[model samples]
Target: MDTNKVDNKGYLDMELLRFSTAGSVDDGKSTLIGRLLYDSKAIFQDQIEAIEKASAQKGDEHINLALLTDGLRAEREQGITIDVAYRYFSTPKRKFIIADTPGHIQYTRNMVTGASTSNLSIILVDSRNGIIEQTHRHTFIASLLQIPHVVVCINKMDLVDWSQEVFEKIKAEYSAFVSKLNIKDITFIPISALNGDNVVDRSENMPWYKGSTLLYHLETVHIGSDHNHIDCRFPVQYVIRPQSVEFHDYRGYAGRIAGGIFKKDDKIMALPSGFTSSIKSIDTFEGEIEQAFAPMSVTITLEDDIDISRGDMIVRENNVPKIGQDIELMICWLNETPLKLNGKYALMHTSRECRCIIKDVKYKININTLHRNEEDKNIGLNDIGRISVRTTTPLFYDTYRRNRNTGSLIIIDEQTNETVGAGMII
Candidate 1:
């Protein structure tokens, strides 16, 4: 099993699970990721040597597995992850993309950025600490982002002598808090990432626990239903015109499928320009696929030569997304500057872009408490708020919970051209 030469076709056929790791500082977020990669033999010899040398320099008796993910120089020195670091690894069963997010309260925005696209989230809880505020904060963010599954990894069991009582207490408390959220699935696993207990291999120490290891659960979790396949949504990112002599008349609309199944000869409507056409062909580099679904990029040619371009969407005639200029949604303020209700910012959704003004500040949520605060209408950095946005053009969109690709948007500050906010439409 040469890892580098992992069967390309087999890997392509295997399911990909995008998961994010989150926890408070010193809670072994990076260590757990490294453990998964190491125990599964995903790292190369050079990587192992580099980790060993780095560990020895740090005067660590054990291999500093955290070094695998904390790649930044400042992060290595400060011993705190300051930014979202992405790591990719694969097993026989599934491919994985891990978003190792920061745990500090100030980096809530970074956590959101990391977890937004994740199908699952692994929140580490130090057994000694039980369930803490950061745990609540991360869970709330996970719920807000509509992450389908959560794994509460009660880490550092070695410090607590592998006590089942400690693990149960933390799990019970966290479950009670999560019941109020929209999270559909939750699993609790007790492990010591540093000691390599119950991360990849089953731990002999945890005979009392019968649950599968973290990697097993990750490989087997039901993610097929994670995508929204009911609503047909495709935002045209580009209009392709072939210049080659073989196909000079070729015209195809290019973009990733935002939602639902798009098949050949299906009746489609181009958005923002209400023209109707049937799909002539769904083209990919590997030839035309008979059908395409969410997350797959393809070029579609229409039977009728209806005018279509970037910022336009192709959707099924029925159950089309609502088109409107006034949109209300929950937004997380990401910039250092406070949100201005009067300010006009550039709003980008899918392949569409428009100038939008924050018409009104609805309310901000207290992340830890999961309660809405209306009196304090000010939305500052890292504050989660509901706001009214009036766009210059009508948007073909769905709620974030329904279609993440079409429902999520970013607000960019026009002056600095910086992304100021992230919004999930209600």
Candidate 2:
């Protein structure tokens, strides 16, 4: 049986796949998503009517599918995506969370945020325009974030009269450029998101093209090993202690597992304190589970009582994370105010918070070209750069490439209480 044809309802369990879409402006990103929703019967009748009425009011001949995702009034009026619009739908094989990111260069922060947790990236290229600078920028960002999969949707094939030559040229050009990137798995597909060709169903328009539809590719892509399951690291969020008579002795450390497999009777260590214990049981509301892994929220009881608290970490005794007060990271400045060398800010990593001082700005990156700019050290809004910082307390972390949850952080301004920058530990 083809699992993709199955109905995704309460009866059938499915894995959730998170993906983000990126492209240049007017490259049919929103329309592509609309087509996916419409053709898959993911949208409700009310939603279809709403967009239809909106299209009529805007004097559009056909229903403006873009209106489905361009939900903000400002975005609809301007015909541009500014903020990241998240959409949810499900096929029989999987549930999907789509982050429809903005296309403009200045909104790089938004794109980064949207793609940060995505397992795959769908980068649309206008068949008429070919590869543009925004294409380079978006692809580089996806590489930098270590996205596991990338599907280049060469869109608007209908405009080019479904020319295979144009598709081959664009694919060749893209292949040459992506050769310099760190992306491991990439696939190219010709599509016309507006006409619903090669989107939800294989396009009959292009007999020369042979590949799975975008939805089919998404449903079957191998994402089972995308998460780190070798190094065990769990940041303790809250300690549960119910002193009720029935459970008076209950003391469980609660957190979402950041990495690795943790099982009952597993030997574990608590960070900063360097205390060791053996796992007693992994508990959930339903019952006791024998094991837990990354991204799963569970309460764990240990055999030995350890002075574990929020900001502490539980890890496998043998494969632990780096502990230090000073580290280097690539930071994307998110605030209007430029970063100041030697300035103090509050840094949050995992469930830990500490004061940190900017030690030095190493270099800035020209995202499009991946070139380092050492001459100008000023890290401003949307600028990605390597910098060193010293934290007031030691942190337990891994390189961001190895573990996203344990290695990413946010810098907050003390006075303004605003998130000024996002960083990935190197």
Candidate 3:
């Protein structure tokens, strides 16, 4: 057995997890976040001391863990999270990025923005309150965004005396509700974010619970397959022509690999043009690479001088994406004004950009119960709805369930120049 080779392979198997926290105000979201960071030893001593001093100045009896994530002046003064605060931390097993979003209903757009690219969503629920309408809304949004995993942290367990009965009751209630959702993986944990119980370390208080700590679960969750690895979709962002004396004939197509893997000498086709080409070499700032995968930005040189440019898609020859001008999408309205019926808008889908118009409002979803109301003509702010759109140019993409990077798009209001809605290809 080759021990050195085994060790080398093991080193490359480590995973990265991106998760976002969503909960109503006072759901102990900030405290749970602070606990995760503190217990993981990701926080610096100086930062802790600074928070402690601030806590004392505020006449707090104990250090307020929520203060660790409440960095904005408005949030501190108002005692509410306004904007999304992103935090990064890592352990020996995995790396993580936390998107802590505000809980207010008006900040639904912010939550969408934060969870759009997340692999998991940590929804905080107050143990005392059990489940509320806000919980349903957040979970629905998580399902709507197609987050792969969800961890329901039943916070403030200490306030409920760490009772096993209480935990089970809440878990059952949440489970029954989430059963209606499309979420595949759902786990519940009884935790006290303030006391750091069952967040990073196992809670001795809750002997009835047998699950791993939240940190352990997060670090161990399988996330490598969360990204699309079957369909090879690369949208050309730019044409790199380094017309220098050293490399006079250099012409490479620069873009990020949106899905699957790309290697040297693989056969690929340019969308809209249907031009066949073979990969000559895949180059990066670090030099040539033998292969590339989702999110890796590289310049690919082809064997043939095909006329490929921006707004074009490079995909596997056999695994071509759906190309069409009529798209059916599930859009989350972000603007206060009602969606202009059949109004023209600009659609941005990966590197392929085009103008689109809402063909018709299919139905509006009731977030609390996930019910579709076709009678409601009002698609106001914070409303999620299904609609059909007609684009000026055809877009080459896969369904959101197949490829998030290529399946999601944003609609801009031409008059206001503001992003009005975000859509997931159905």
lDDT of 3 by residue, 366-386 (tens): 887778999995788888899
lDDT of 2: 0.90
Taking the tens digit of each residue's C-alpha lDDT, what string does model 1 give over 1-426?
A: 444355555655678999998875588876788778876677779988998998899888987776777898998898777788888888877889999888777898999999998999999898999888899999999999999999999999999999999888988898888899999899999999988888888998889999999989999999988888989999999989989999898999999999999999999888978889899999998998999998899999999988889999999988789899999999999999999988899999999999998899988899988889999999999999999999999999999988889899999999999998999999
The total number of steric clashes, by the backbone 3 Å criterion, in model 3 comes to 0
Q: Would you estimate the TM-scores of all the predictions? A: 0.94, 0.95, 0.92
The candidate maximizing lDDT is 2
lDDT of 1 at 149: 95
What's model 2's lDDT at 131?
90
What's the lDDT for all of these models? 0.89, 0.90, 0.87
Model 2 per-residue lDDT at 109: 93
lDDT of 3: 0.87
Best of the two (2, 3) by lDDT: 2
| Residue 255 alpha-carbon offset, candidate 3, angstroms | 1.1
